[model samples]
Target: MTRFAPYLFSLMLLFVAACGGGSDQQAEEQTADTQAQATEQADDVRTIEMVGIDRMKFVVEGEEEGIKTGEKMGDYVLLESITAEPGEELRIRLTTESTLPASAMAHNFVLLTMNADATAFANAASKARDNEYIPADMEDQIIAHTDLASGGETVEVTFTAPEETGEYEYICSFPGHYSGGMKGILNVEG
Candidate 1:
C-alpha cells in the first residue's frame, strides 16, 4: 500500500501539470483569436490621412493640390470635408507639418457632435492646455479627438460615424488656430 501511495502521488502531480499546461494552451489560443479579430476590424475601417499644414489647414493625403485652393466656407475654408456612410467605422490620421516649435504651433483633430458649437468649443479648448487643448468640461460635445500633434508629429483617432445623416464639424483646438481657419466638416450620409 505504501509503494502504491507513492505511485498515486506521482500520477496526481502529472495530472496537475497536464491541467496547468492545458490552461496555458487555452490562454494562448484565446489571445491569438483576439488578435485576429482586431486585425479584421482594422481592415474593415476606412482610414483617412489628414495633414495639418503650417497654413492652418487640414489637407487630405493624395488629394489634388488644387483642393487646397477650393471655395471657402464661412469664416474658413474646407480644404476637404470627409464623406462617410452613416455608422461606418472611420480612422482619422492627423499629421502636423510645421517648422515652428510645438509651443508656438500644434494641431489636433477634434470631431464634434452635431449639436456642439464648434467656435465655443474651440474657445474653451484653447484654455485647456493641461488637457492637450481639450476642454474637459465640454467633453460631451466631442465625438472623437486625437492628441495634439506637434511639428513633424502625427496622431490619430478611430470612431464610428454618427448614425444620423448630417454634417459634423471637425477642428483643431489649438489656440488661435481654429480662428485662423483650421477646421473642416465631416458629412455622414445614409
Candidate 2:
C-alpha cells in the first residue's frame, strides 16, 4: 500500500502540472488572436491626403479647387469634400507648404460634430494657441484633428467615421481661417 501511495502522489503532481500548463497555453493563444485581429483591422483603414498651400487652401490630390475650372487654389474656400460609409476607419494626412514659420502660417484639419457651431468653435479656437488652435472646452464636439503642420511639414490623424449618418463640418481653426472659407463638409452615408 505504501509503494502505491508514492505512485499515486506522482500521478497527482503530473495531473496538476498538466492542468496548469493548459491554462497558460490557452492564454497565449488568446493573446495571439487579439494581436492578429488588431493587425488586420489596421490594414483595413483608408487613407486620404491633402496639401495645405501658402494661400490657406487644402489642395486635394487629383481634384480641382476654387469656384471655376482650373482656377488657382486659394483660401476662404472648401478645397474638396469627403464621403464615407458609417463607422468607417479613415486616415487623413495634411501636408503644409508655406514659406512662413509655424506660428505665422500653419495648418491643421479639425472635424466637428453634427451639432457643433462651426463659427463659434473657430472663434474659440483662435484664442487657444496653447492647445494647437483647438478649444479645450469643445473637445467633445471634435471627431478627429491633425496636429498643426507648418511649411514643408506634414501631419496625420486616424479616426472612425461617426456612426450617425449626416453631414459634418471640417475646418482649420487657424485664427480667421474658418471665416476666410477654410471649411468643408463631410458626408457620412446612412
Candidate 3:
C-alpha cells in the first residue's frame, strides 16, 4: 500500500488536471485556461489519421495490413512516418478497426519525448492497463498521446510539435503492440 502511494498520487493529480475543479471560481478559471490552451494547440494544426488493426499494425489511408513482403517484421514498413515544422501543432486521430472485442484488443498512441527510453516506457505501460496503458512515472517522457481506442472507436490528441528538429518515435502502448512493430517516427524541422 505504501509503495502504491506515489503512483496513486500521480494518478490523482492527472485526474484533477484533466477534470476541472468543482467550484464556480475554479470552473471559470479552468474554462479560460482550457480555451487558451486549445487555441494554442489547435492553431494551424496538422491532422494525421490512422487505423489500428488487431494484428498490431497501423494502416494508413487506403492501405491494408499484412501484405507479405517476404521480409522479417522488423523490415515491415513503418506504420507512419510524419514530417512537421518545429513549434507547430499536430493532431493525431486514431480509429481502431479491430474485429476482436475491446477488452482483447484496444490501441492508443503514445508519442515519447526525445530523451525517453522507448522500450523501457512501453514495458512499464503494459502494466498500467487501468490507466489507459500509460505508465504513471512516464508523464514527463510523453510529449502527447490519445486515450485507448476500442474497436471501431476513435480518439484524438493535439499537441505542439517539439521545438527541436529531429526524429521522434511514436508507438501503440498496448501490451504486445510496440514489441510487434507497431511504431513510427515523427520528423520535425524548423
Most lDDT-accurate candidate? 1
TM-score of each: 0.71, 0.71, 0.69
Error of 3 at 98 (Å): 0.9
Question: lDDT of all predictions, in order shown?
Answer: 0.83, 0.82, 0.81
Show where candidate 1 strays beyond 4 Å: 1-42, 64-78
RMSD of each: 10.1, 11.8, 17.4
The 10-residue segment with the lowest total lDDT in model 2: 63-72
Could you tell me how far off, in angstroms, the CA of residue 137 lies in candidate 2 after the best superposition? 0.9
| TM-score (C-alpha, index-matched) for candidate 1 | 0.71
Model 3 RMSD in Å is 17.4
Clash number for each model: 0, 3, 0
Ranking by TM-score: 1, 2, 3
Give the per-residue lDDT of model 1 (tens digit) for 58-166: 7653544223334543333346677888888888888888899999989999999999999999999989999999999999999999999999998988899999999
Candidate 1 residue-wise lDDT at 157: 89
